[model samples]
Target: MIRYVHMYLVAILLVAGISMSFPSGRHSKAEAANDMSVHAKAAILVDAKSGKILFGQNMDESLPVASMSKLMTQYLILEKIQKGDLKWDDVYHADATDQDLSTRPGLGNVPLYQGQSYTVRDLYNAMTLVSANAASRALGRMAGKSDKHFVQMMNDKAKQLGLKHSSFVNTSGLNNQDLAPYQVKGTASDGENKMSARDLALLAYHFIHSFPNEMDIEKKELDQFPVTDSYSIPLRNKNQLLPNGKYPYKGAIGLKTGMNDAAGYGIVALAKRGQRELIAVIIDAKNKKGKRSSKARYMQAQKLLDYGFTHWDYQKISPEKFLPTNQQKIPVENGTKEKAAITSKTTVTELVPKNSHSIKAKLTLMPKFLTDQKKRELPSTYQPYGLIEVGASRVIPSNDRKLTELTLSFRKLLFFMLISVIPHF
Candidate 1:
């Protein structure tokens, strides 16, 4: 009699542990992530190939993105050029107004003559390397046939790109001083462009994947001299991550940079080593004690990229590797033999940290044989409760090198186990 009771008690404990894997929870949100100490108000890191958000903080908060908006204009230019609507050798004439705006103090520009013309190739080089406002506006005119039409196209592209929180106010993001020349109705009038860190990283990802060939120019800074029909125009790349720039990081590559009083210093930064590519964004990283530091944004972005590369890697994890059998059968409360079977939901084989370990499976199975009509035959004092909702359960797809995370609530499992079985207790 004693030995039989001990065996039954052991089965009860095992079944309780399984139910505890997941139970009804009253919590509303996930716990906070570990500290990274990133100074940017909003930041995110995304895997280039998988499009997975490896790290994020305030990723959906829309904020100004200064010169970074230029990437959109750059994308449109590349698309038009690729589709044969525009050619590299085609001429673009910067009117007298464009020249005047270029010469404006804080507005980045390369000189142009009113009547003189520049090849499409020269304008692209200037825009990517120097982030020239005049260069972007000229490309905008060509892409959309006018500045207003170009702004519309930018918004349209943002929608198509699935940028729910991104909108462009201008091509170059030079919203300083008098608004007369730069004003475009319906766009952010302050010359500020707004995008969440996630959306900005998505933009960079879209640009790189769509026009893989164009990244060559952004990999480094260069002295550019695009000659007009009348004079030579001098330009230099301003992105600090470039080889010749002040804070050049070894793996940093092509993208764009933007800054204004409102947007602070920001970069849509990309880095590659071996086969791994990472896209990181840091926006509104300002030094409150003094004036804003351009290097802060760059350093933050570099920090994120380095952390992702160093701590994160891909590995395959299978529950079967750790379990005696992938499937198990448990007994119903009154059954003489185990009839209900449960198996590991899925395996995880996607990008995980170097230290990631296999997760233990805790699953509860209810026999399909028990029906409502059968339950009525039991004593009124006996209550049965083991409700499983497959749809609501945490089931991650383990195919195609993807990782499905698993979580269990031991408390709920224990409650279900003790209540459904052990009728006398």
Candidate 2:
């Protein structure tokens, strides 16, 4: 009896340990249900391929991005690498600015000595995996002569990419004092470093889509640098969801996280489960001691990924099916031909959710007609009129039989009138 009781106790302890190791189903469901309950200033979930916003709250409100700025840094660096302007093995020397930026407390540093040489690959790894300020500054210096010029390039690239509400004041995001050289012109406060959740997600999407190979760098559980022979820094992903392994999801790749006292906690997470990939951004999440913000972001991202996977499916709707059956031929006045045929240039297909149907399109013709302003002098050749822009909405198609007949009749009448008038001339 004593032996039996001891065995039973051991079994109970083993079961409890297993349960603790694995999250309960009830807890998972609860977490899924209350994913958005965390205190965050803004959050957004976007379809990685289409860039469609799946869910969002306060996404447009711009906020400080902290180290999330490194996304752009990584993007630009990779772009340079692809362009063959820079190589990963190329060695770069740290400047005074790089040393100053890296030495700041609270910011991650690569421990670069002034004029020390480091490879572009090492700097990139440090900037991305370790969020090293020194590496970022070194990259900026390597990319351009000065941080200001590199920042200008960043802003220019942002504008080109349609990031309307984003601005970069510094490469390192160091706070600027009134007397500081990098401070905003004619202002005491630090130069503004801001980006909206939407913009950040879009940036993430571009990074992941443009550079699939570089993404592996982010997934590294550990990477060693030859900078120091004796010392090795174990690299761990700042994102906890990647290692959780409990969630029924896959294709979750890599992204970056950011935080500063002013910016709070900002996250740009990318995940893919099956054919669908999503990028999520959480900015200005209430830290409440900083630990909870990452947890909140993970919960929110998990819920979003689950929701997307459950509710969304990709369908290849052929554009030909949505096109108008009858191509419009309009009479051209005083041209080589009496009429010109206008047809839809391309088919429009949309990837929409299931159970959704009925897409409508509207075409607006510019100049209304092919005739000139005066409508008196007929041109020698038939000139194509205005452009036709197609817009689609989820609406039932209306019957236009009577309108179609009237349009045909008007075209015939106009053609005859033009013919008759040409002879009279």
Candidate 3:
């Protein structure tokens, strides 16, 4: 009797430990991320491929994103180009409005004269490489056929992309009041483009995945845009993390940056080291004294990227490795065969801790497959009859790998039941 009681107590403790180790529900939110000191008003880090947010702080608060709004214009341009509705060589004639805006000091513009014609490629380079306000507005007008229609397109595309907390007021991201006569109508005259940090990360993820080649233009250290036949303005990429920039990071690639009175300083940064790619977004960054600093956004991004690369890794786990042999098959009721095999349909890849292997698989059968379900005829071979939730330690959540080829069997069912009853033990 004493031995039996001791065995029961041991089993209880083991199961309790397992339950405590892995919590219920999806991947943990920002509150659960590891502690880190970040000075930005909002920031987030996400896995590029899986779209899993690894860390976040006030990430959902909508705030002005300034010139980062050009990313939307860029996306629309690439989208139209991909559909063949637009071409890089297409010419756009500058009107008085564009020429006037291009010369506005402190607005990040290049020289342009009314009635001058420039190719779509030159304007795009200026917009992306140097955050040129007039260039972005020109691309928007060219893509949507009208600036008003283009602003609508930007908001519409934001919805389609699942940017829940984003809204656009202009193609250039400048405050609406700054646009003056060219301000997009039907919006608050003082409003600027706004997006949560999480939304920016999501936007960058889609941008890079949809048009990976855009990185080529983004990484360029220097380029020139012609304001006249013989005179051109030098365009320099401000992303300091680039290899040729002031604070060059080895793997940093092209993304986007933004700044304004309302937005302070922010950047959407991407980097690839080996097989892992990460997206980091920092917004409204300030210096130690809480004043806006041109370099603070990049430093915040560096911290995020370093933390992500140092602590996490991309891993591909085979189904066989996590699914124990005993749980591979389950019993089906009133089926042609007494037993059925439940196998993973594909390998699961996710972000997990570096140099660690502690993945656990939890199998949940459909309600109909429960052992106590009323006898009902089941197909001999049913695809996706169950799901396997795989997690690595407490970091990851159920990736929901489908389990296929389920049938019914007595002996294997008995073994499955025995293990299910004492799964951890």
lDDT, candidate 1, residue 186? 63
Question: Per-prediction TM-score, please?
Answer: 0.69, 0.66, 0.78
TM-score of 2: 0.66
TM-score ranking, best first: 3, 1, 2
| Cα lDDT of model 1 by residue, 35-143, tens digit | 4556787887767754555666677778988888888889899999999999999988778877777677756778766777888888888888888778788888888
lDDT of 2 at 414: 21
Best by TM-score: 3
Q: Model 3 segments beyond 4 Å from truth?
A: 1-34, 320-327, 330-338, 343-346, 367-425
* lDDT minimum window of 10 residues, candidate 2: 4-13
Overall local distance difference test of candidate 2: 0.56
Model 1 compared with the native: what TM-score?
0.69
lDDT of 3 at 44: 82
Tens digits of lDDT, candidate 2, 1-425: 00000000000001011111111101222224445343577777666765545456666667788788888888888999999988999998766766675666766766775767789998888877778866886788788666767888788888876676788876655445411554434433665468887778878877887899888887664676545545555654555656543332365666877877778766787877767787778776654454545465656566666766765566543222323345244444443454444432222222333343443332322232222223333222221111111122221112211111111001111211112110000
Question: What C-alpha lDDT do the candidate models reach, one value each?
Answer: 0.62, 0.56, 0.69
Note the residue pairs that clash in candidate 3: 338-408, 338-409, 339-407, 339-408, 339-409, 340-407
Decoy 3 TM-score against native:
0.78
In each prediction, how many residue pairs overlap at the backbone (N, C-alpha, C within less than 3 A)?
6, 2, 6
